[model samples]
Target: MIIQAYNFLASWQLFPEKGEYQSGNRPKSGYYRINASDDKSRLNIEHTWVTLENDAFNATFSIIPDGELHDFENAVLADQFKASIADTSNLEISFYKNDRETLHVLHQITPNGLLKITQTGTAPAGEQFTNIEIYHKQMSVLPYAAAVSGAVIRPTEEGMIRHKALTAMEEQTNMQMDQIRRQIELLALQAREIVSRKELSMLIYNARLNFSPVIGQVYYLYEKKTGDHQVSMISPREWGNGSGPFKTFVAKVKLLADHTWVEVE
Candidate 1:
């Protein structure tokens, strides 16, 4: 019987044949092409190879007795068989001849494209075997097309990568903007300091002048205890007007530096 199998993990279609077989419904052997789906991820096999015949094989596999027509009633295989086929792997097949007799076959694929088959006899009704199951594990079906020879890439995975890249770019932009704002604030502070220095220099220059002093010259003045005042051309304002018998002068002076007058002398 023609047997066809599918490997979901590798996305491969396999045809297992032993010898030449013929049926009225079988087609001539040729290259069959399947077109990709709209997303170019899934392949759609043509309709000519979709149906099952006495000789043709597809995703479904069945067994029939010798020298008989298609017997759908006594088929012992499951509706679907799940198996993993790699370069080198092993598989077990069991067949029952009667209620008291059974046969077990172990098929191994070698690295050099040879199948090693081992046969053994087992007791009938030994143990009831169920399906295969693994604990605490789950497999996700990929929504995108995966190449048979390379790593699998999912659409959600690509989206996550893009999201990370955008987040990093946004953070970098924010950092640059903060740096620019800080630079502007620093420049504004320096400008305020410069203006304050200019104003302090102007105050010092003004304090150095007497009532009739020159616009840019430094001088000193003194006020007597009797309400009379004295003006001096030199600093420290030590010369006082002695209009009264006892007179004392308040010492007030200005200094000069950097071509400007400062009220310290």
Candidate 2:
């Protein structure tokens, strides 16, 4: 065979076996529990090895009722035990009894999954008291196991999603109400302008007139008496000297060719 620039495969080997693609040494840590089954803290593993397969096995184990929560207590277990065993079908756990270190009553999500506590004593796991952070007020003692059962104070994924949905709905409703209020205010302003124009048109039409009013001519409206109104050719500025025909100036208007009264700018 011709050699490549870097390397070359000169010949094919004669073999009857299939090639092994990968070959490397891996740590067998899971078997440690099975080998040390006789030991007290061997963690009570059965003959089954499926749980330890491909597992890191670096995970440590600890019991409940510790006065101070260490690394294994906080990392591996919840603060309180709900004593939930309903979903134990999917859990991968193995435990042995140690009154000192073994948590007979477990409420934690282990690295493999849920905990399976095996008690070696006659006491029913409930008698064990866990580390409930206690503070004495008057006449109290340390390590008081107050068993209260109701519901776990844990926020769920569905609850968080519902909260966000309600918040968005509230914001949307407020915006719609503000838009409706603005529309109502605009309608009120338009109504007021219409009423003012109608009153002005009525005054000019009812005023006394001896001559025919010309189209496109500006005229001033004034009050003849306290209640009576009139139209005049003289503007308010020109009425500065001896203008007694009308007293109070009302508005300025222009006559349209259509015989309809229109106000001047």
Candidate 3:
């Protein structure tokens, strides 16, 4: 019975109930309709007192007994109507009495917790149908209907959760990259400042010695073998474990094709 209650409540929430009557047929404003023109929108019933004028009685009709999907099944109703919100609003109920029959109450919210009241002429007076069905939007088959009504195709227990996690990770990665870029720029500036001969020699011998901790220094000078000028910097952590092993930078400038000077700082 809870399933029935849940199904009925869900249907009432999803489908529109009767509002005020328009002309003699169209429902009033604020109703759920798959497709309604400016003149006609389906009505959703949240309160008991809704004016059912015009052809409001059409909602009172019972469904004829059918195979799998009767009015009770959302998917069945959707499929029988070709799964169209626009088209289903115009459809009447299709049911059968041979197996079971049901009639839906149009205006009144019945005590049965029924989305709409169901009347089965074939059932015993005290017997009530207990089967309730739950259905999800068929994305592939009912894309247009889902879009028009803003229906979730299939809700997952973890889809939203996973998406949030991935978003957070991406944000963290961007922050780390930004920090590294800043450090790189700082190192470049330090290298440019190590232009003096004394500073360059200290850097090459101490920082680049592989046994020193004098890091965060820059150096540059001429090199004989490579015959090219170079500038570089190093961090304390990059070369040595402590201050004794001074981590340093070295750069060499070429005086001639074969002559070079080393700078350390």
Comparing 1 with 3 on TM-score, the higher-scoring candidate is 1
Separate clash counts for every candidate = 0, 2, 46
lDDT of 1 at 36: 38
TM agreement with the true structure for every prediction: 0.24, 0.35, 0.19
Among all candidates shown, the one with the greatest lDDT? 2
Kindly report which residue stretches of model 3 are placed more than 4 angstroms away from their true locations once superposed: 1-155, 195-265
Ranking by TM-score: 2, 1, 3
Model 2, span 169-195: residue lDDT tens: 545776887899899999998787566
- Per-residue lDDT value at 226 in model 2: 59
Candidate 2 error regions (>4 Å):
1-156, 210-218, 241-244, 253-265
Sorting all predicted structures by lDDT, with the top scorer first, yields 2, 1, 3
Per residue, candidate 1 scores C-alpha lDDT tens digits across 121-191 of 43234543222111110122112211101111122444344334533654677689889999999999988
CA lDDT scores, all candidates in order? 0.34, 0.37, 0.28
